[model samples]
Target: MAKFIINGGKKLSGEIKVSGSKNALFPIFAASLLTEQPCRISNVPEIVDKQVMVHLLADLGVQMNVSPHEVLITAANINKTDLNPELTSKLRGSVVLLGALLARMKRVTMSFPGGDSIGKRPIDSHLQAFEALGAITQANGVIEISAEKLVGNKIILEESSVTATENAILAGAMAEGQTVIKLAAMEPHVQQLCEFLNKMGAKITGIGTTTINITGVPKLHGAEIDLIPDSNEAASFITLAAATKSTVTVTGINPEYLDDFLLKLKNMAVNFEVGKDFIEVNAPTVDYQAIKIQGGLYPKLASDDIPAMAILATQAVGKSTMNEWMYENRLGYATELMKMGASVEAVDSHNVIFTGPTPLKGDKMTSSDIRMGITLVIAALVAQGQSEIEGVEHIDRGYENLEERLSKLGAEIRRA
Candidate 1:
């Protein structure tokens, strides 16, 4: 495993463009299977997860033309319905294919999906949604799902799970009848998937809302699309700028998607300006105030961004409370931060209390997960001494060329 050797206390400046959304691209990749024609997607980030996703698609006999930041996938002839167990286990996002494959071939078999060890991320929602859409599931260590003919039905998700909603939408897109989804996830990535499906001739309405309707078509045609800029990545850089009191402008960001996060930054008195497609963080306020932060469903702070917000809280003047009920171990990074001299108390599995204006000194740390890894990188950038962060692979899964990108922004970070 590669490690990041970062010399902290360096102010970062210059404009850094956020990469295409990893979350958005995964579903788009899976959705390509709905059509036999070629689907070309631009703005594809070269992340490890994308690599894994492409491999999985290739294993299914989809012909692909992949380049830096671009991919053209032609699922002209898919030879396999069973997902490769080893490849499928490496990526949690692989679960989205369950719906996509079912829509195309009506049969898919796979073992449990794997991802970061944040907490329990169950696929019960996916299976339940499929069952509601007239698919039968058999599970005994491995899962075998098949549908004779999918007929859409009203599905009220167990929770507003993004992937589950994507799965339901994918299956509903090609089902025989109209499918109604209530209490669906309205995340930006979910919206992107909906829009992309519509572009491919799937009739979907009530986008950006809890309730969505899909009129199933017999088949979906391939279409080209551009992936949206990753909001989580934009949030990470914004936090990095504020944590180090740097002047960094993050471009290619849709400010609308980051409203809650930006509001939190504004409340903290962090100096930042939001443009049509950019957010520039100037020198941070001298005495930033601590604020309460909660992670919830969309329009609220995203659970993925909670870790970066926690790092920002560490530099605030007063105590800040972090409530992340979405994942049990999302705040596991608090202990690693404590090692770097931050005042942190793990109040409970779901809550954390941070007391700040603490000068962090570099310490050895592990990256644990994607969000946790980037959070540590931001923390290390502002720390006093050099820090060695292991598990760079986890960071690469989400952020594309992160060390190289941050280095160009004047950060003294190097992959070792």
Candidate 2:
């Protein structure tokens, strides 16, 4: 039970470089199982989720050379087709391996995957997509998926689930014929996976759209790829800057990926500048009007960023609302914020109303999930007095070396 100790009322000023997207790397790493050639991926973040993925890959006999900045994976000699429930339960990203294993070995046995206890994130889409690819699926205590030959077909996901769409893509990349996916998730990370597979010789088109067409190739050759900077992490620092009324310059960002969040920042009257690879934010002296945040799909405010926006709303001039229609437990930290003197109320399981500019007082809190965990940290960093946040493990799953990075930016925070 590690904790983060923070001395509040520090104005975070200085430049901080965000790591590569952890979310982007998860599915791509699993998708690497589709190819026999050595795949080189750079700009990987060193986080708990990545380590868990590497551990899962090791169990499957994929030789990996992992470092702080990059990862080289060659699944040419995989010996196992089954992933254990223990490792898979650690992170939900493990479910993405289903399509890859089916693509390569044509058989896979596993239990239900797990990650955050946010809600009932069902893998029905993953199994449904696999069945669409001509695979036979069974369900007992364990799920057994097998196929004689993967034949591509059209798949229209039920709800544009990201991992389900990714599973279909991974399996479709190696299937026999053309695979058409309609109502696919058009997230930046999903697009990144499409681009990576294309570089690996899979002909994928209509990226960043609702419809994705994939032409299955016989074999995929390994290629080098770089991950895009994490927009969520970039947005985290920008929210901190505004909450503390400080100046922060975050480097290593692609401005286009963060257009929606930037628009909301502007609407909230937070002065900001975007460059080729950087975002500089300056907080105004007076609190600004409330801004409604719709935590929907990509090109919209993502669900992961909902908590941070709620934290920003606590210091806003008027009433602000955050609606996370995706997950029921996304507002778990709202009660925690109330402990810190924030006028935030969980209006429903999926929505929260924040009234500000309420003065926040530091207190003891715990991380509920990755997004909510960091949001609490940002609130604690700006609150009056000392704040201790339990559950560093949850925070480490997403952000890499958060305490050290924020420390460099003048935040008096340390792991304890």
Candidate 3:
């Protein structure tokens, strides 16, 4: 087991280059299985979640090589259609392979996926999309699916679920006709996936909207794609700078994708400058007004960001509220924050209220998930005295070389 022994009250300052999107690359990696040629992806993050994902792909007979910043994947010799049960249980992203497998070999079997238990993430949309595309689905302890001939049609997703929508798009890419997806997820990562598929010869329009159109292609050729910087990680650093009232610049980020979070930062009179590809945040140690935020679908705050937002709320002068509608279990992180002397109330599963300007005193804490794990580290950074944060592995599953990166910005952190 690894731990982060953090001496808090350090003001972080300097530039940190963000990594590629874990959310974007995982699905893209799964989508590569749809093609026989090699698909190369650059700007890949070196994190544990991706390692788990890569292992799952390797088990399914996909050939790949990983460098620091790129991965070349070729699926020419795929020897399996069913996913490894143990491997799939380790990654939620494994569920995405349902569409790619059904598209390539027309059969797939897998048990339920396990990821961060932050919410009730159902794959009904994925199964429904496959069934709409002419696949048959049978659900038992393990789910089994097979399709004779996929006939593309209109798919209307009940919720703006990102992975389910990507599954639909991957399966629809090879269907016999046009497939129109309504009420689709329009998150930037989803658009990036669409762009990647388009580069590989799939016709997809409606880049950032609720309605998306896809025309099936006989075959897709391999293409090299560079994933955009991880906006979620970017949000984490931005909140860290603000929570500690430091001046830090995050580079290689898409300011356009950060609108949902930046608006809230601006409302609190937090200081920041946005460039085309970067955002620099500087938080003064003085008091700021409390604010209310709601996390939701694309063009809005993402649920993964709620933990960081809660940390930001803790630095304000008065009471602040964060309403999370995406996940029922997300607010559980507040218990750990309270151990560091934060004044937080978990109002049921979907809401949390933070009474601000609490002088956090660092202490021992456990990590529940990836996002919340990083949030705890951020809180420890600003908390007075020392704190031992276990579950550093959870933080490692997302952020790459987190201690090294923060050390460059003057954080007193060491990995144990």
Clashes per model (N, Cα, C within 3 A): 0, 0, 0
- Indicate which candidate wins on TM-score: 1
Where is model 1 more than 4 Å wrong at Cα? none
lDDT of 1 at 141: 90
Per-model TM against the reference:
0.99, 0.98, 0.98
The top-ranked prediction according to lDDT is: 1
True-structure RMSD for candidate 1:
0.8
Predicted structure 1, TM vs. truth: 0.99
- TM-score-best of 1 and 2: 1
Which stretches in model 2 have alpha-carbon errors above 4 Å?
none
Point out the worst 10-residue segment of candidate 3 by lDDT: 281-290
Which lDDT tens digits does candidate 3 get at residues 336-357?
Answer: 9998888988788888899987
Model 3 misses residue 305 by how many Å?
A: 0.8
Candidate 2 TM-score to native: 0.98
lDDT of 1 by residue, 283-362 (tens): 96568899999878899889988898888889899999999878897787899999999999888999999998899999
lDDT of 3: 0.89
